[model samples]
Target: MENAQAVAPKSANSKQNSARRHRFWKQFFTYLYMVILAIIVMYPVLITFITAFKDANVQAFVLDFGGKWTLVNFKNLFTQTLYGSWYLNTMIISVSCMVIQVIVVTLAGYVYSRYRFAGKKFSLMFFIIIQMVPTMAALTAYYVLANMLNALDHYWFLTAIYIGGGIPQNTWLMKGYFDNVPYDLDESAKLDGAGNFKIFWSIVLPLVKPMIAVQALWAFMSPVQDYLMAKFLLTSESHYTVAVGLQTFINNAQNQQVVLFSAGAILVAFPIAALFFYLQRFFVSGLLAGGSKG
Candidate 1:
């Protein structure tokens, strides 16, 4: 019996050692994988930032920061190209789309949430399904329609298209947020002799500002960064967004101004990052709450 107890204790110690070793390896591998993924994800941004500061003599792939660094690329990007105009155009389109989209989506969401309407379920389902469809699938149709309206080169037309593209998803977001708001508020507003429009604009809209911020952020981003639709719709270089303007730097196979491109890319991230940071709280709350309730 003494020998048996001694052997059991030894066995337990061995098992404990094995478990500790197993856990150590497991955590090591998990952290290693995370580090590797972080590296992979950050590699492009790191390279872009590095290259943006590099001189013309430095190769794009050189990881050495001790080499020559110059701000000339960024200076040339503004002076030598239509980058300033492109930036202005992108801001105009993004802001225009954001304003129109927010107002329309807010009205639509309020109506859907507060009123009993025909084909409401079908409409909601259609919004969900249509959002799943890629905009590319209807690219030809949009082009044809733009041609029909003689608006192929018009900036207003492009902004309108951006607004339309953002509507489905934004509407769904607003509707999800509205679903969380209690109907008792609407009832209380009615008891105070408030109409549907008053209730929506004054009370309900204020309550759902988080979702509005989320929608506006998305609406603003789509136009500013969109390359495909902007490229297809706006043929005039003078009217090009920043994305299309950046593409011009690489079109020359013989002399690609990658340094300038990198600088421009770095500049592109500033507005997006700034906006996100500013709206971080509302954006995060809207996303999390909408996901849970929707």
Candidate 2:
């Protein structure tokens, strides 16, 4: 009887240990897969960053993984190029676009979410259809319009494109977020003698702040990284954004500054990477809330 009891408990202990081992391997493999995927995705950027500090030679730019490093890329990027002008131009466009996009998107969202007007459904559907169409499809028309207005070289013209192009999808996103807010809040504000605009400004806006940040980041980043529209619109080298400016390095027939391009790309990436990391919490939550409703 004593032998039988000991044997039964030992078998149960062995089963428990086997189950724990299975679970440990499962979790370990899952994490290992994720780490591998992350490395694959980031490999190019990592290589570019590594190449940025190396000398601008055929071997340094293309062949070697690691070698003697120097700061010449950074020095050349600043001194031999209009990188500062490009940075300033992009900053101006991005800031302006962000401000305009937020206001327009918020207003459209508020009206659609709160008020019912004739053709409201049709208008919203129109916007949804518009979002399905690629912005590049309208590039020719935009170019013609810019030419007619002589706004081809204007940074504000690019700013308008960023705001206008983003409005359809962004307004839809904002509307979805607004739909989640309780109508009771609006009614309560009204009972306190608050007007419609006042309620929207003071009561409603505060609740959707995360979505605002999301839209602001989108607006800013779109113009910052955009090469196509800026390329078509901005005629002068001085007005080039980082994307357009960076192209010059590769396109230069006489002196291809590949290492310098890598350095400049890294500089352009830093602020955007930092901003995304800072606002990531709000960004994910806002995306969830914004996409929750019809």
Candidate 3:
């Protein structure tokens, strides 16, 4: 009888251990599935990075896992292209747009959140409806309007487009975030003799720093990545952004020089990737905070 009791308890413990092992394997498979998905997403980026370092012979043919490495492609990128001008032009547009958009969006967000003025609902609805309209649909109007203002090929034009395009969603997003902030803070600031701008600048803006950072980073990357609008808008080669500059590389007689193209792509992707990493921690939190209300 003692042996039977001991054996029964051992059997129960073994069954429990087996169940736990089975659960662990199930979780491991789920994680493995996600890893595979991540690899699929990242494979193209890895290939492009590797291709940038490959020698001319390897670039002309299918990629081999074993290939000669060379800095010739990177050298070609610097010598053969107006990379500096493109870099400068893109930086100007991106930075200018980023600053303008952040300011405009923040102010708009604050107003929409705090005010109960007439037409408030209608104005918000209008912005929402405008957001739903595709940017391409307004291409004709934007082109004609910009031309009328003689703004085409001007660096500031891209800034205008970037800020205007981003405003509706950003306004709503920031406004929603502001709504969740305690109104008592605003009251206390006012009682302490803080002006409207002071309260907004000091108290409110500091609290919404995460969302602002995310928006600015996003704004900075837009014109840098945009090929279509920038292509159509900017007629001068010197005025071309990085996206257009990369296209120019392929458009010229050296169409088959894939390594040079790869090098340029890598350069173009670097800054945006850095910006993404810099703001990555705040991005999701900002959006979630913006969306949630008290």
Which of the numbered candidates is closest to the native, going by highest lDDT? 2
Please write out the lDDT profile of model 2 over residues 1-294, one tens digit for every residue.
Answer: 999998999999999999999999999999999999998888887888888888877453443565787988888878888998898899999999999899999999999999999999999999999988888989999899999998999977778878889999889889888888899999999999999889999999999998899889999999998999999999899889999999998897778778888899999998899999989998787777766754
lDDT of each: 0.86, 0.89, 0.83
Tell me the lDDT of model 2 at 167. 94
Extract clashing residue pairs from model 3.
Answer: none
Give the candidates in order of lDDT, highest first: 2, 1, 3
Clashes of 3: 0
Q: How far is 61's C-alpha from truth in model 3 (Å)? A: 6.8
Q: Model 1 segments beyond 4 Å from truth?
A: 118-133, 277-294
Question: Which is the winner by lDDT between candidate 1 and candidate 2?
Answer: 2
TM-score of each: 0.90, 0.87, 0.85
* Residue 83 lDDT (model 2): 92
Backbone clashes (count) for model 1: 0
In the range 1-294, model 3's lDDT, one tens digit per residue, is: 999998999999999999999999999999999999999887778787778889866534344557677888888776777777888899899989889898888899999998789999999889989888777788888788879989888877767887788888888888887887899999999999999889998998898888888888888878887888898788888898988978876676645666777788898888678879888988877777755641
Alpha-carbon RMSD, each predicted model = 2.4, 2.7, 3.1
Which number leads on TM-score? 1
